[model samples]
Target: MNAILLILIMIAMGAIIGGATNSLAIKMLFRPYQAVYIKNWRVPFTPGLIPKRRKDMAEQMGRMVVDHLLTPEGMQEKFNERGFQKQVIQILQREAKGWMHSKRSVADLLKQYAGVTDARGKMTAYSEEWIDKKLQMFIYHNQEKSIDEMLPPEWKISAESYFDSFAARIADKGARYFESDAGRVQLETLLEKFLQGKGSVFNFLSSMFGNDKILDKLQPELVRFFRDPSSAMFFKGFIIKEWEKLLDQPVWKAGAQLNTKSVARYSVKALNRELTVLDRLDMPIAEWAPSYEEHIINKWIPELWDQVQPALSAKLLSVFDYLELEDVIRERVDTFSVGRLEAMVLAISGKEFKMITYLGALLGGFIGAFQGLFALFFS
Candidate 1:
C-alpha cells in the first residue's frame, strides 16, 4: 500500500508539472513574433503563430470584419441600442457649439460679411438706374409681330412642374440677397424715403436726362411690379412695408384675411396682361420652354448670369441650440482595438480559445489531476 501511494503521488506531481509546462508553452506561441534576425543566428520558429501565416491572417481578418462586423444588420443592431440617438445628437451639438465658440468662426464670419457688402455695394454703385435701363431696352426694340408664333403646339404637366420648380428656385435665390444686414439697411432707408414722399430715385435720373417725361413713361412698368410681385420683388417688399404701416399691424397674421387672396388674384391678372402684351409684341417670355433652353443658354443666360445670380442665392445664418454632450463622449469612445486578440477571436475556433485562456491554468490542472488518478489505479 505504501509503494502504491508513493507511485500515485509521483504521477500526480509529474502530471501537474506537465500540464503547467504545456499551458505556458501554448501561451508563448502567441506572445510575440519575429525575434531579432541578426548576423547568422535565428530563434528557430520562436516568432509565434501569427508570423507563420501573417498575410493569410490579414485577409482572414478583413473578411471577418466585412462578414460579421460591418454588415447592415450588425450596424443597425448597434444603432438601435439604447441611448444611440441621444449620443448622436449630443455629438452634433457639441461640434456645433465648439465651432460657433471658436475664434476662427468670428474671423470667418466677419470676412464673409465684409466680402459680401463690398462686392454688393460696388455692383449697386448705380444699380437702380442700370437695371431700369436694361428692363426698358428689353421691352423695346422688337419686330412687328406677336410672340405667339414662338409658342409650342401643346402644354405639358411635367413641363409646368419644371417651370414652377425653376420659378420657386428663383424666388428662393432672390430671398438670400435682401436677408443680409447691409441689404436690410439699404432697403429700409429707400422705402422710408419713398413712403414719406421725400425721395425720388426717378427725380435724380430725370434731372440727369434733362426731362421728367421718362418718369411718366416708366409708370406702366412701375405699376406692373405690384401686379406681378415675382418680377418686382424689391418693390413688392416696399408695398408690404407701406401696407404694414397703414394697417398698424405687428404681424402679417393679424392683417385682413383677404390680403393673401387679393395678392394672388392681382398676381394672376398681372401675369395674364403681361402675357397678352408679350404675345401681341415680339418677346422671348412668350415662349419660355425646355426646347428654348438651348437658345437662351447660348445667348442671354451667360451674358446676364453674373447680374442675375443674386436672384438665385439665399442667405442663411445658422444658430444652433444648446444641451448636447453625451454624444460627444460616446462617439469619441466605444472604439475597441486589441490587435492580435482581435484577429484571433475572429478566426476559426479561436473564440473558444479566448474563453479558455482566462481559466486555462485552473482547467488544465483539474484535467491533469484526473489523469494522475487514472495512472495510479491502472498501475
Candidate 2:
C-alpha cells in the first residue's frame, strides 16, 4: 500500500509540474505586452521576443520583398509575358467598352480620372490654369522641333498641296472674270477717260473714228487676249509662286496677332467642341472596334510599347525608390497594433505553434518523471 501510494504521488507530481512548465512557457511568448520595470531596473525578458524585434522584422521584410519578390527583372519578365500582355489588352478593351456603353458623359469620365468633383457631386470644366499648364508641358516637349518638322512628311505635303491647287483655281477664276462683259465696260470707260485727258490730237482722231466704234473694237481684242489659255496659264503659275512664298513664311511670324499659345488655345477650343458633342460620344464602340483593335495591335501598340519598354526599364527602379516603397512598407507594418500582429502571425502558424507547445509539455513531463524516478530510487 505504501509503495503504491508513493508511485501515485510521484506520477501526480510529474504530471502537474510538466503541465505547469508548458503553460508558463506558452504564456511567456506574449506576456508583459510591454516592458516591465522595477524602479530604475528593467525586469529581465519583460517585452516579448516578437515585440522587441518588430522593427527589425519590418525592415527585413521590406528588404526581402523588394530585393527578391518585387525585383525589376522579375517585374519585367511578368510584363513581357505574352499571356500577360494579351490579358492586359483585353482588360483595357473591356474597360473602354464599358465606359463607351455607360450613360456617363465625357465630362464625367474626365472628372473621374482627374478626381475633380464639386459639392453638388457634379463635374466642372477644367480650369484655364490647368489646361495652360498641360499645354505648356506639351510645348516644352516639342520645343526642339519646328512645326513643319513635327508634322509627318505626308501630312505636310497633303496640306500644302491643297493650297497650291487653290492658288491656281483662284487665278483661273480671275482670268475668266477679266474676259467678261463687265470688264469690257470698265476698260472702255478707262480708254475714253485717257483719250479725253490727252491733248486735241488723240481727241480729234477718236472723234473721227467715232469713240463708240473704237472702244467696241478695242474691247473685243482685250477680252480675247485675256481669254487665251496661255494668259490663264501664266496667271496660274504666278499665283502658285506667290502661294509657295506664303507657305515658306515662319508660323510664328505669319501673323501679327497670333502666337503658339493662341493657336493651341484655338485648337483646344475646337477639340473641346467636338469632344462635348453628345452625339459623337453616344456611338457604340463596336462601330469602330475592329479598326481600333487592328491599329492598336499592329501599329500603335508595337510602336508605343517599344518606347515604353526602354523608358520603363531605365526608370522603373528609380521611380520605385522615389516612391519610398521600403519606408512605406515598414511604416505600414509598424502602424499595425500588437494584437493585430499577433493575430496575423497566429493565423499563419497557429498549428505549428500549438504543436510546439504540446511538444514542450511532453518533454517537460519526461524530465519531471526522470527526476521523480531518481528521487524515488535514492530513497
Local accuracy of candidate 2 as per-residue lDDT tens digits, 338-368: 7788888788988887777666666665766
Model 1 scores what on Cα lDDT?
Answer: 0.46
Provide backbone clash counts, one per model.
6, 0
Indicate which candidate wins on lDDT.
2
Residue 128 CA displacement from its true place in model 1, Å: 16
lDDT (C-alpha, whole model) for all candidates: 0.46, 0.66
For residues 143-218, what per-residue lDDT tens digits would candidate 1 score against the true structure?
2222332224353333333544454454554455444555455555654455454457655654576332443444
Question: Lowest summed-lDDT stretch of 10 residues in model 1?
Answer: 314-323
What's the TM-score of every candidate structure? Answer: 0.32, 0.63
